[model samples]
Target: MERRTDRVMPPRYLASVNKVIVGLHRLGVPLPMQALTVPGRKSGVLRSTPVTPYEVDGRRYVVAGYAKSDWAKNARAAGRGELTRGRHRERVRLVALPVEERGRILREFPARVPRGVTMFLKAGTVANASPEAFAAAADRCAVFRIEPLD
Candidate 1:
C-alpha cells in the first residue's frame, strides 16, 4: 500500500487518491479530506478538488500550496463553493486575505502543518522554513479564509 502525498508523488497518483476520496465523501464516509466544488472561471462548469481545510482561530482556511492553482482560481471566480465531509456539505464563501495577513498565515504553516511545509518546500511554493522566508513567499500563494454561507 502506498500513501498519496504531495512530496515526490506523481500527479496521476494524487489525482487517483483524490478521486477515491471524493467518491467516499459522496458516500457519507467520514474522512479528513474536503471535496471542494466550485464553478470554473472559464468554462463555468463545476470543478472539484481535494484539499485539507485547516482551522486557525476558529476560522477555516485553505492554502493554495501550488499558488494560483486551478482550484484557487475557480474558487476566486465562483466566490462560493461546496465543502463536503462525509455526508455533510456546507456552502462556503472564500475571502482572500490581504498580502500582509497572508504572509502571517504562511509563516504559521511550517509550525502548524510541517508535512505541508515539506510538500510545499519541494514544490517550490515555500522557499524555506524560516519566518522571514515564509513571509516573503506569502505573496506568491493565495490564502483564503472560508466562511460558511448560511
Candidate 2:
C-alpha cells in the first residue's frame, strides 16, 4: 500500500461522513462515537469532530491519528472542550500527553479502538495497525487525556 503524509488533507468523503456521524450523535444515537466540540485556535469558532475514546484502566483518552490536524491544534490551545455521546454531554479538559508517556496508551489502541487503526495507517502515522506499531509512533501521534469537569 502507498503511504500518505499526515500533512495531506483528509479525503473529501470524510467530511460528509463526519457530518453524518455528528448528526447521528446529536440525535442521541447510542454509538461508540462521540462528538468533540472545541474552539478553533485561530478562527475561534467552535468545531465538532467525531472521535473514538480509548480507555485504559480508569482513564479515557482521545488520539489524533494525524498529529497536526486542526482539531488537535485547537484542543491544545483551548485546553477544554465538550464531549457528547448520545444525549450525554460533559465538559472536559484535554491534557496533552508527553511523547514518552504515550507508548503504553497507544499500545492498547489497536485492541481498544480497532476501527480507528485504519486512519493511522492511511495517514502514515504508523507502519501497521499492530499494538507495537502504534506504540512506536507515539511521538508522531497526538494523545490527550480526558478529564471531566464538574
Candidate 3:
C-alpha cells in the first residue's frame, strides 16, 4: 500500500467536483460520481458534496475518508440525506454501525470496494498498511449504510 504525501483532492478540485456531479446527474447519466445533500446541524441549511458510493452485497454505503468529517457528522445529526446519480435520486437515512460490527465490514472493506479505503490511504488516514490492516483501520473511519427513505 502506498500513502499519498499530499492531500487528497486539493481545494480547487473539490470545489469543482459538486458542479461536475450536478452536470452529470442532470444529463441522466449514471457514474461513480454522486452528490450527497444533508442539512447542516447548526445552520440548518442544506449542504451538498461530491462522493463516490460503494456497494457491498447489494447494500450501498459511503465511507468518510476522514472519519470525523463534516458531511459524516451532519448526516448523522440530520439522520437523513439525499444521494443523486444522474437523474436518479434517493432520500436515505443513515444507520451507523457499532464498532464491533464495523470491524467486520472494515476487515473486508478494502477488497470489497474500490474508492473509500484507498482514498483514505492517500489522505494519510492510514499509512501503508497491508490489505489485512484495513480492518483495524476501519475503527478510524466512519462507515454508514445508506437506507433509502420510503
Candidate 4:
C-alpha cells in the first residue's frame, strides 16, 4: 500500500458520510462511535466530531489518525471533552499519552475496532493494518486516554 507522507485530512467525501453516521447515532443506532466535543483552541466554540474509541485492558482511548487535525489539537489544548454515544453522555478528561505509552494502546486498534483500521490505512497513518504496524506508527499519531468524570 502507498503511504501518505503529507499531513492527512479527512477526505472531502467523508463530510457526507459523516452526516449519515451522525444521523444514525442520533436515532440511537448502536455504532461504536462517540461524538467528541471540545473547545476550539482559538475560537472557544465547541467543535464536534465522531470518533470510534477502543480499549486496552479496562481503559478506553481515542486516536487521531491525522495527527495534527483540528479536533486533536482542540482536545490537546482543551484537555477535556464530552463523549456522547446515543443517549449516553459523559464528561471526560483527555489525557495525551506519552509516545512510549501509546504503542500498546495503538496495537489493539486493528483487533479491537477493526473497522477503524481503514481510516488509518487510507490516511497512511500506519504502514499496514497489523498490530506491529500500528505500534510502530504510535509516534506518528496521537492517542488520548479517556477518563470519565462521573
Candidate 5:
C-alpha cells in the first residue's frame, strides 16, 4: 500500500473552516467535537483549530497528523483554553501525554472513529497512517484533557 504525506489545507479554506466550527459551537449543537486553541510558542498569539473528537469512556480526544501544527504548539504553551460544544462553553486545561499512553488510547481508534471516518483511516487512505506515524504526531501535538470548570 502507498502512503502519502498529509496535505496542508490552503490558508483561505482553513480560515473558512475555522469560522464554521466557531459558528457551530456557538449554536449549542451536540456533536462530537474539539477545539484546539494554542498560544503562539514564539509570538504568543492565540491559535485555535476545530476538530471532530473521538470519545472514549466519556472523554473527548483528537488524533492529529502533525504535532508541530500551530494549534498544537499553542496549547502546549498556554496549557489551557475554552472548549465550546454547541451552546455550552467551558474552560479546560491542556494535557500532553507520552507516546505509550497515547498509543493505548489510540489503539481503540478504529472503534472510536465515527463510521463515516473509517474510510479515511483505512489501509490506503490519507489517514492509512501507521501506528508510529500516529505516535509521532501525538508526541508533537498536545493531547488536551478538557475538564470542564463549571
Candidate 6:
C-alpha cells in the first residue's frame, strides 16, 4: 500500500488508520472510529477519512488536528456525512463545539486511549504526552461532534 507522508499529513492517512482499526474491531476489539467524508466545497469530489473517535453520552466525535486541512474545509461545506463502524452505519450531521466543550472532551481523551496505542502516543504521533499535554494539544484541533440520524 502506498502511504502518504506529507508534512501536512493529508486525509489519506485517515483512511489507512481506519483500515487498521476496522481490522482490529473485526477481531473483537472495538476501537472508537470516526469517518470524515465530504463533498468537495469547490471541486465537488467526495473525500473521506477515517479517524479515532472520542465519545460522550453515546455520541461520537473527531478532533481535527489541522483545522485548515482540506477534509475539514470539505466537511464544513457538506455539513453531513455517513459514519460507519463494524456493521453499524448511520447518517450524521456535523456540529462544531464551543471551546469549553472541546477542552472538556480533550481532557477526557486519555481514558479512551487504547492500550496498544502507547507506541504511537509515546512516539508523538498522536498526542503522545502526559494527559494534560495531550489535552492541550487536542484543544488546538478543530473539534466536531456528530448527531446520528435515527
Candidate 4: C-alpha RMSD after superposition: 1.9
The lDDT, on a scale of 0 to 1, for candidate 1 is 0.75
Quality of model 6 by C-alpha lDDT: 0.61
Clashing pairs in 4: none
TM-score of each: 0.80, 0.90, 0.77, 0.89, 0.65, 0.65
Off by over 4 Å in 3: 1-19, 26-29
What's the alpha carbon RMSD for model 1?
A: 5.7
- C-alpha lDDT values of all predictions: 0.75, 0.87, 0.71, 0.85, 0.57, 0.61
Per residue, candidate 5 scores C-alpha lDDT tens digits across 34-148 of 5555567788776666765566678866655345556766776777777666666667776666665776555545556644234334422244444444443334333555555
Q: Which regions of candidate 1 deviate over 4 angstroms? A: 1-12, 129-132
Per-residue lDDT of model 1, residues 42-98, tens digit only: 999987787777777788888877565788888887888999888888999998787
Question: Top model by TM-score, which number?
Answer: 2
Task: Give me the candidate number with maximum lDDT.
Answer: 2
After superposing candidate 4, which stretches have Cα over 4 Å from the reference?
Answer: 1-6, 26-29
Q: Residue by residue across 1-150, what tens digits does model 6's lDDT show? A: 212222334344555775676566455454456445668989988666666676777887776655566777777777777665655667888787766677666655667745424533433435454556545554345678888767
The lDDT-based order of candidates, best leading, equals 2, 4, 1, 3, 6, 5
Q: Which stretches of candidate 5 lie over 4 Å from their true place?
A: 2-15, 27-31, 36-38, 42-45, 57-59, 115-142
Q: Ten consecutive residues with minimal summed lDDT in candidate 3?
A: 2-11
Candidate order by TM-score, decreasing, is 2, 4, 1, 3, 5, 6
How far off is model 6, as Cα RMSD? 6.6
Instruction: Quote the positional error of residue 113 for candidate 2 in Å.
Output: 0.3
Residue 115 in model 3: lDDT: 58
